[model samples]
Target: MNVFLGFLYVLKIILSSVASIFLMIAIYLLKKLDVFHINLRMLIMHALLCIFVNNIIQMLRFAISLSQNIKCSSHNQFPAPFCAFLCINGVFICMERLYATFNFSKYENENFSYFLAKIYAVLWMILTLCSLLKFWEGILPGRYNNSLNCELQMIRENPLKTQWHLILTLLFFW
Candidate 1:
């Protein structure tokens, strides 16, 4: 059992590493092509970049857990904000598409400035950070009260709350 589990873990690490490498290559190619100069493409690239970074973080956390014989659950909190931002980015992408759809004439003729996209990305990051802090407060009261180890269980303990949270999050993202 232990050997099988270790094999599965190693397999996961290999797959994650391969995916990250592919993302890096894709990002490099996109950069070389200057795709980021376009507003929508810039936002798409940001999402890819975030995924790549999140993957790297997960891999590093896994490696650390293996090396130190520590459980990976303790590292869960670190990626929450990344996940939140990715969700928010998806919302921004949709909003951009909707705007383009509504203003097809101007959107097609005008070379939209990347400045606005950059500003939106930065603003979303700030808002996500603030909302995530509040979200944690709601999900796990006394988050800083030496209860870090059990924080994740709070979500699992309340199925209805979790479901509602997911529904609300999806609605907000949409």
Candidate 2:
């Protein structure tokens, strides 16, 4: 089981890194060529940013799980970093989808240049702030597994907080 988990962790890291690199390259190439008109470029840029954020979240989650299992420094690293990533990505996902649904007619009526750019910038800033604040609460030191591991307490011990998160995420996604 340990070996399997280790393999999965490695694979997850590699895949996330590769995807990030690919997305970066795609964005660079698109910008360099200047081939696409304004509307298409805006859409492509939005997609690229979304993909980058999602893969970063996946990488952070994998790191947290592995660090916990190996009894590393989960307090200073795991909960905060992982939670920050989750919060940021979650907000982005929600905002992007919301914009598409709420402002679909705007895009259809006119070019997406102004609207897309503004929404993307606003979403990124909001996500950054939300993630930093939410995860910062778990920055204090704590012990786990009979002091063998010092980390933020598990979600199981704080079901109320976890349940709220689950519900909020569900609502955002749904």
Candidate 3:
């Protein structure tokens, strides 16, 4: 019974991952064209790209980890560095846009100064480097419960830190 259920669980993960990948690709395709040649919020675009790629990687890691022939629960630890960075990057993008929108004088110079745009690009590049530091500090999914249809529980060393980090970054968007 457990084996049958485990098979079903793996199937679900595969299906969901595929669906997510498709959705991400579709979104990318839809945005292939732009109204403006120069975009000020390029950081948001880079962040979104990171997120889409990271999600696919994370999903693949999860499915592979779960499908490993072992019946025991808790097999994977995808650090998902890019995924973690997405939260903070989201806030940064919001803040950058807000600042640019509010202080248009600096960015709207007739000389093609584009100070804000330059800052946005440089900031994302730096943040991308910084995000690499925690590429291996992602979620730890523990034991799959049969009753929960193979749902795994989170087993974290610092749940508070994770929770607070998410909450704090989210606050910036609001």
Note the clash tally of each candidate. 0, 0, 1
- Model 1 C-alpha lDDT versus the unseen true structure: 0.61
TM-score of 3: 0.52
Per-residue error for 161 in candidate 3, Å, reads 5.5
Q: What tens-digit string does per-residue lDDT give for candidate 3 at 1-174?
A: 366756765775776677667766655654575532234334445555655655565555445546664344332322334435566567656665686689778755423226645755675576566545433432334443332322233324555543554455445433
Model 1 TM-score, all chains together? 0.64
Residue-pair clash count for candidate 2 = 0
lDDT leader: 1
C-alpha root-mean-square deviation, candidate 2 = 7.0
Residue-level lDDT tens digits of model 2 in 111-137: 557776786677667666765664454
Using TM-score, give the best candidate's number: 1
Q: Of the candidates numbered 1 and 2, which has the greater TM-score value?
A: 1
Q: Evaluate candidate 1 by giving its C-alpha RMSD to the native, one decimal.
A: 6.1
In order of appearance, the predictions have TM-scores of 0.64, 0.51, 0.52
